[model samples]
Target chain A: MQSIERLVLLGTGLISGSFALALKRARLVKRVVGVGRNIENLERALELGVVDEVSTDAAQAVRGADLVLLGTPVGQMGRLMQQIAPNLPVDCVVTDGGSTKQDVCALFRENLPRHLAMCVPGHPIAGSDLSGASAAQFGLYEGRRVVLTPLPENDLLVVEWVRQLWVSCGATVYEMSAEQHDGIFSAVSHAPHLLSFAYMNSVLDRYNAEQCLDFAASGFRDFTRIAGSHPDMWRDIALANRDSVLGDLKANVAQLNHLIQLLESGRGDELTGFIQRASRARIEWGKPKKG
Target chain B: MQSIERLVLLGTGLISGSFALALKRARLVKRVVGVGRNIENLERALELGVVDEVSTDAAQAVRGADLVLLGTPVGQMGRLMQQIAPNLPVDCVVTDGGSTKQDVCALFRENLPRHLAMCVPGHPIAGSDLSGASAAQFGLYEGRRVVLTPLPENDLLVVEWVRQLWVSCGATVYEMSAEQHDGIFSAVSHAPHLLSFAYMNSVLDRYNAEQCLDFAASGFRDFTRIAGSHPDMWRDIALANRDSVLGDLKANVAQLNHLIQLLESGRGDELTGFIQRASRARIEWGKPKKG
Candidate 1:
């Protein structure tokens, strides 16, 4: 694989900064240019050696870059793409570390139409409560999974190049359509997050909420861990993936109603069965994966 | 602090065994007699010093006991109480480590009417996925919280004795009504378990469930950790605390419905506010308690 001469990072935060660090460690990139609105974060990225250079102007940063990574919230990616489109090298491969892909695919089409053949929308399944350039680490993607949703116009070689780059950063890459990615993530990630948030709100609304929270133990801590997530980022995700998220949320409500019916009817046998199914599946899922 | 001459455990399991171990360590008990249908567990309790002796007969176990701890499930407590009613010494102080207090209080009223002054229903907040005699440890209740719901007919001294015993076991004890105990636990523990189970079932209902499970990460794992709980145990809790659990579940449904409505109408601002409310409350709840 050809090494990246100049790699431009649209958002120099945990995801993109870590990617830059990993690529630098693997000696797969010649220079990394960190671009962000926050000058302090850019300076931190430079000091941390996550990037060889820093730029507040995305267009200037992408002028001579062979690769551009859009590693920001889905809401910010479109604007970033538009800012760099006029100056992006024609041969530059554009990819992303966004959590949601369908909206990102649309953004790329809307803002970088001429670079569609080089755009490969991707999502790295790595997440951390910590953010900013300071949270970047060289091994963040080690043993992580990355899903790439390539457009029909995407060059096959360019897609393979992006996949190999992530592999070099120690990620297992899988290919799927943007629609499939949204559905899978909505079921596994987006819906669960929303459910956790809603459950937290429900607990807070109780008459003895303070007492309830005081008595909450490990179970409550683990169940609501994700409820402590950043509000703005999750809001963008909830809005950006609205359709898939809504579908799964409705499915969850249907499940709750069915469970309520079982409880109301005092059907002990059915309730046991209901709980057993979930318990068995979760236990099975928790087992170490077999190679 | 009158040292118990004989401490009888109605069930040789984690809660009871731990209580016996804690009391033995404090030298507050002279003998511990473990009674269980499973001869192996009883023998294991005896061998592990969780009990001084083992018995298969609850009536025989309480014959010379000064204190009897009914550590069996709520469903079995009534039967155990009935069995020991005839053989229990007049001066014996009978208490229990049942999770739900109202039902246990009723059990005391039904079978040990003459022992009402000595019947103190309590709940030890310590829980583990593991069970059986081997899982019991001397410090299991160290720094843990124990809530005692004393019956109005009970002698004040008897409640104080129970509280002191728990304190000796390295626990902080609080007094509350059985109704309040049930309501609080239902909101914090029981309802969360049931909701997690329901959420897991909902995810399993998806056509891409296996794929989704394969791709699930930390958030899914933490959210569903409680869903892997023992089905029979959680089922009993859901039934025993039926009214409170049902109310909380319904409230959760209402919250989800409101969220779905916002998402369906594309109300991004309102949706952000909803998530923000939950996120802020959870973050606050997670902070260290003020001195």
Candidate 2:
């Protein structure tokens, strides 16, 4: 095993940038090297003290690194893996910060040389909509959940090392199938975002029709604020996890339709019970996790 | 009008408490009488300087008031109006800070005396779930929107006076039909709350089933935090504006279902377009309004 004298993080956006900061803070790694398409972002990462060095060449960045984190968007991961897979040294642990694990793992399996047993597909469920290294903060992963989906053929040491990385960043690790991860996330995160986006559109349409946008208050602000998320990133997420997200969308619609039908039927008592049950459940389950 | 000496605010919660602060800041009223059932809340409001005085007796508090705001939950408005209606002086301008206007206005029309032309139904689109007068802060209404729904036969001077009061508090006032007001709010505010509540319930169910609660991150926090809102207040809102909320619920369900079906059919282009449109619309509508 090559000693991890240097760490190469691909695509230093929020997650990678945060990982860089956490690694530096924990003194887990000696040198942090950030690689991204945007030179400005690479410069910002260095300025923010998130990385010890910056590089634009994907292959050169990963050539001698003991650890490489594919932190690019899911859609862009395939191309990134293709560029870095050949240069990745033997016994070097490789992981990712992608939301969807199965596809990223598949990409690595297809592209990486057979000598690499260290590739693991992982996801850290700790991020804000804000992108780029500038938005990265130290506590981003504090007390958050990290899921590692390891291939059966992959060495257990790689999985453990990947887990340790997130743990150092203050994440609680979990083991799960990539399919399960995708489905569960689609239900919780993707569906809610899509709903928020669509709801904002409807309100904006109505307000624009009546020229009431200026009359909008904090209520509107609170509901649609998440709609301001990075469009390109979300676009990629929605498309990459299309199947699972679609399933969640169906469930969400069914739930809302049931609510609407009950209301249309003037079933106040049932509607009240439904909402009451939902409210009680949410109040009980929605407490924040410790960082 | 009788000499304005004292001001009494009923139900010293978020809106009332903020108004109390605004009134104190403006020095418009000589004294603030806070009436509520929770003694702790009353004391806390006093401790927080949200009110000059606190009381539990609805009638006693309104006896000498020149201006009184009924700041109780909408469901309790009818009963509270009955208790305070007979005690209000002839010259007192009785206005409410309830969200649902039509029902509250209907209650007032049936209960209030003819001389109380100052009885106005108000819906201030400002506030957070953190309730009670202690949550009150000055500048709460700055750049917020306040809607006043008055009956055609109601005194115009009284309506203008109520409008002027919110104006003084830095809110932009708009006049509209109670139906229109409820419809708009149901779409923008009430439905969003219900969605948040329901989504949080789903998250909780998953947590209970598989222990995923510990893994929730900023995305889940941002989406479900609002689910911790006051259940009683939401119950009142859902019950009072049942029909309009139901309409919005159905519309939301349809929108969600349409997106889901498109994704299920693998129509990436259409889904992308939909999200892009929604994102653009939300971006345009997301300008910050006052707290």
Candidate with top DockQ is 1
lDDT of 2 at B242: 88
* TM-score of candidate 2 on Cα atoms, chains taken together: 0.88
Question: Residue by residue across A1-291, what tens digits does model 2's lDDT show?
Answer: 223578898998889888878877887888889998899999999998888899999889988888888898888888888888778888678888888776777787778758347888888887675788898888888877889988877888777878887888899899988887777777667767887877766665564334445555555566566677766667677777888777666666666766667656766677667667766655666554355
Model 1's TM-score against the true structure: 0.97
Pairs of colliding residues, candidate 1 = none
Candidate 1: deviation at residue A193, Å?
A: 0.5
Instruction: Write the residue-wise lDDT of candidate 1 on B66-99 in tens digits.
Output: 9999888787889999899998899999998888
Q: With candidate 2 superimposed using the best TM-score fit, by how many Å does residue B37's alpha carbon deviate from the native? A: 4.1
> iRMS of candidate 2, one decimal?
2.5
Best by TM-score: 1
| Candidate 1 deviant stretches above 4 angstroms | none
